[model samples]
Target: MANLLVTGAAGFIGTNFVRYWLEHYPEDRLVGLDALTYAGCRRNMDALRHYQQFQFIHGDIGHYENICQILREQQIDTLVHFAAESHVDRSIHGPDTFIQTNILGTHSLLKAAKTVWLDEQPGLIHRFHHVSTDEVYGSLGPEDPPFSETTPYAPNSPYSASKAASDHLVRAYHHTYGLSTTVSNCSNNYGPYQFPEKLIPLMLVNILNNKPLPVYGDGLNVRDWLYVEDHVRGIEKILSAGIVGEVYNIGGNNEWKNIDIVHLLCQEMDRAFAERSELAARYPLAPPANGQPSTSLITYVRDRLGHDRRYAINANKMAYWLNFNPDIAFASGLRKTIAWYLDNESWWRELLARAAP
Candidate 1:
């Protein structure tokens, strides 16, 4: 059985990925490391307690020595790096954390991996997979093609810039130091266990509470959305069959305008509340509970600073090389996501409470 180390294992995508890995590779021992920052919730991984082979470590990736010790002790054959300061608004407000965590933290992890996997055990079979985003390609025009592996780096936000720097370091490690590494840049992801700060969850929560659903600018900015499970499958394909030192773009090929997505969520929430009689009592604050449309809560707000107009990914490389493509459609995925939040009220409620200042 393979031993794997997954950083950022308490965050949205990382939590999902860790659960996915344990479920599929129950024989494989997995160590999950997270700094447990605001976005990284330890409770998100509570379900993982059932997996005897899985362990969670509350530690910052910025510490190189700690990482080295973990690698050496765990005998981790694979390191999946996912830790990053991902929220755009937060990055704009506090760029220093982004730089420290995304850039320096990644470098520290790389160094630790190099020390343990390459230097200490020269011939060890190891893979260092760096998870990244499509924002590094900067904004795309209305007619611009989707971002590909060959796309040039033109990061517009502090978050994306830090990610770009980390991506460069991963590349350098693979090329300059001959580390067995692969990078996958994915599009937007949405599904269960997602923190409410993101667009989809935020809208869902606000609609449930009758709070204003803030839509940025005219809300026409576009983004490709990938289901969380499909992203896990794509990452599995890369780890299994992908070429070392190569980059793959994972996308759902599902593009939607921000306003359109908000409207869709409103409609879905209304539909759910209409079909479920008990939902009215559970979420009494919702507009649907009062026989009003959830759409009534939509409120246009000021645009974010340096918000990318569009971001799309070209996953042809993943398809051609790894035979991987996202499976869940936007409609089906949205329904599942809505159902998750509605059913797991306690989970989200506790999360919101803890996150509250």
Candidate 2:
């Protein structure tokens, strides 16, 4: 069995990736390390509690000794790094944490990986895969083409800036020390188990409680939305077949403005609730009031500071080189995602209760 170390395994994308690996690659032994920070919870990994192939470690990557010890003891051959301080609003409020976690923490992890993995044969299957976001490309004009692997880095926020620094470190390690490494810059991801602070889940939670569905600015910010499962699959493909020192962009190719996404969610929620009410006699939780439309809750709020105007990805490299394409379309993916949140309120409600007041 291949021993794999997954950092930040309790966070949204990290947790999803862990679940995907455990279910699909039964032969692989997975070690998940997470700090269980405000955005990460052990509950996210509840389903894997009974899996013999999985293990969880609670630690911070910024501690080099701890990370090195884990890598050495676990005999980890593959490192899939998903740890970072990722929220833009939180980064805006306090950038120091972002710098500490995203930049210096990545540096510490790379140092450990280089020390441990380089001691082996010159060319082996050992790999370090870095997960990043498309925000590192800054904003795009209305007519500008989507971002590609070769796009110049022009990060606009503390979160993106820190991630950009980490990306640079990954490339430098590959060129300078010959560490086997690959990086994937992905677009916005949404689906089950996501923290409620992000746009989609936050909107869903708010609408459920009859709270304002805050839309920043005119809600015209464009993002390429990739389902969390599709993104995880793309990452797995790249980790297995991607060339070392190459950068791949994983995107859904589903470009929609923020307002359009909110509107679609509203419609889906309405339909779902309507169906639930029709089955109310059998399902005690269903109510006639559940079918009431909820779109009237959308409230336009002040635009977030330094919000990127547009973000789209050119994922042709992923498709052409890796034969990787997202299996879920936006509409279908959105419906599945809505159904998941509707069914799993207990998961997100706990997160909200624990969030810093």
TM-score of each: 0.99, 0.95
Model 2: residues with Cα > 4 Å off, grouped in runs: 119-124, 278-291
**Who wins the lDDT comparison?**
1
**CA lDDT of every candidate:** 0.94, 0.90
Number of the top TM-score candidate: 1
- Give candidate 1 misplaced runs (Cα > 4 Å): none
lDDT of 2: 0.90
- lDDT tens digits, residue span 219-337, model 1: 99999999999999999998999899999999999999999999999999999998899999999999999999999999999999988999999999998878888889899999999
Task: Find the 10 residues in a row with the least total lDDT in model 2.
Answer: 279-288
